[model samples]
Target: MLYPPHQPLQAAAIPPQRGPAGPAREDESGPWHTEAVCRRDEAGLFFAPSKEPTAARLSREEAAKRVCARCPVVIECREHALLQPEPYGVWGGLTAAERRVVLARRRRREMELKKAASAPRIAAAG
Candidate 1:
């Protein structure tokens, strides 16, 4: 029996079959960062909303803080932001300035709580 010519090469030339593309479910084990699907301008800032043109015109620093208002992963983003202490851009939907403000407030609250916990209680006269 005559063997097929270049049978191995013919098999290699055939393309692998592929299934139709579909949306993937949210991955619980995967990284918590949001996907960068929004359109950005030349400065790497997200495109402004047409309805809120005034708000859209805000500086990159302010715009980032606004992102947290609507973001679903704000908590995770804030945790990552605190760990990394990123200098610029939006992380967990907060701007660099906003993060600094939040940290300061947190420290202030902690100090107040500590002071209250350590205060001596007055004894009632028998």
Candidate 2:
């Protein structure tokens, strides 16, 4: 079943996705945390509940990203999500899988840069 029959239609509706709400908790006071545009949105949209179907989850994630696309602090949010290596849900306009692709590309670029940097030194030493 795409969704449990008992689940209300509203349950699948897209809501504004955000970070932890209310006054910045002591532990969440980092600059990115405070600056997040999602802070004012509902936190649930970004996360998939256990057992969510693949189709539903994809729809939900896209909805959450719509909010991210309009956010002012999207760059900070993306950086935080990438650095945290968040393993689930949608954050900063990208899903977990998309983040993986980006991370892989970034790693490849970093390795190439490192190799380039070392080549000059290696040649000098030889």
Candidate 3:
């Protein structure tokens, strides 16, 4: 169900469960989630508390990313986030802002690819 299940694994994304509970892993969403490192850490570490101070939030995010760094399922987690376009929290080591940037870049890249594919090819005069 997640990203067609055939794409090559890459670093980074997550789902809309970006609430205070953090990322959600369903029993049928496949087994990659069972191995997430974030599962062992506090959910609050990934989601920001309302009205949290800037410095504290950054520190917490860094900590969460540290956990994600060693995660074996980081790629799956990140892909989930990007596909779902998770609106908040950190997933697969990326903060919400970072995910937005990534999504934008993906959109731009997709457009470029589509344009290239649709362009006319020039023939050589023999």
Best by TM-score: 3
Return the TM-score for each candidate structure.
0.51, 0.66, 0.74
1-126 in candidate 3: lDDT tens per residue? 332121223412333243333344556644566567676666788889999999999999999889889998888778778877778888888999999999999999999999999999989899
lDDT of each: 0.49, 0.65, 0.73
What's the C-alpha lDDT at position 102 in model 3? 96
What shift in Å separates residue 12 of candidate 1 from its native position after superposition?
A: 32
Residue pairs whose backbone atoms clash in candidate 3: 12-78, 13-78, 13-81, 14-80, 14-81
Give a tens-digit lDDT track for model 2, residues 1-126.
111111234552333334333222234543344445555666677888999999998888888898788876677567656876777777778888999999999999999999898875535564
RMSD of each: 16.8, 9.8, 8.8
Name the lDDT of candidate 2: 0.65
Regarding lDDT, does 1 or 2 come out ahead? 2
27-125 per-residue lDDT for model 1 (tens digits): 764333323211121324532334446545467536645655565556765655565565555666666667789888988999999999999988999
RMSD of 3: 8.8
